[model samples]
Target: MEYYISNFSNVKKEEVKIKGSKGSFIQWLVTKDHGAHYAVRRFTLEPNGVIAPHVHKYQETVIILKGSTKVCVGREVKELHENDFIFIDSGVEHAFYNGMDPLEFICIIDYVDDMSIHPVDRSCI
Candidate 1:
């Protein structure tokens, strides 16, 4: 068994590219434990940042931690604040926008055995 705590002091921050966008930021804190082709990541988005619309072959769940956001799943759009959560089913186009200051959340993605088989297409942005 593996155990770990991702305190802000030890978590590494990285930038995520937003396709066709001028500016955006995403910080990630990956957990130490890995499940069957799945992973957990703590993600933070800056104000006005967007993840862009895209779809994956696997499922994903997002748990909001701070600030607020507008999430688009399929054809529906919903505003989410702290303590809110959302689930994105496989093959559904989904995206997130950080509209209320800095947004922090955790994203858990379940994948198949080979990640290469489930390529992420970012053409719908």
Candidate 2:
């Protein structure tokens, strides 16, 4: 699929769950035309919102768009502002917290078809 960069913005948006949060997110593109085998999401987080600790079989990259957030990658914790980005490797525990007002960001994850591969165990902490 040859996608003109000009026509890329024509893609539709969809809502998705941000892992452990009650909040939802909007996904702009996750197709073959986007040059990604994974999903890409653009979403906002409300004040005090949280995306709980979890790990995946595929890597994920998050780019902060607005406001501030606290990100935990394994044992490390850092405060991230706009333009900040974080890369999480597969099987590493991580989560995010919106500590300073509402936060917006883009999260990209490589798509995996097997549900057995992305085993999310909430009881593991």
Per-candidate TM-score against the hidden true structure: 0.76, 0.71
Error of 2 at 40 (Å): 1.8
Model 2 TM-score? 0.71
Q: Write the per-residue lDDT of candidate 1 for residues 1-125, one digit (tens) a residue.
A: 35445576576666655454323544445532432346777777778877777666777889999989888777778898999999887788777777748888888877554333222355332
State the C-alpha lDDT per candidate. Answer: 0.69, 0.69
Worst 10 residues of 2 by lDDT: 115-124
CA error at residue 47 for candidate 2, angstroms: 1.1
Question: Relative to the unseen true structure, what is the C-alpha lDDT of residue 68 in candidate 2, on a scale of 0 to 100?
Answer: 87
Q: After superposition, how far is residue 95 of candidate 1 from its true place, in Å?
A: 0.8
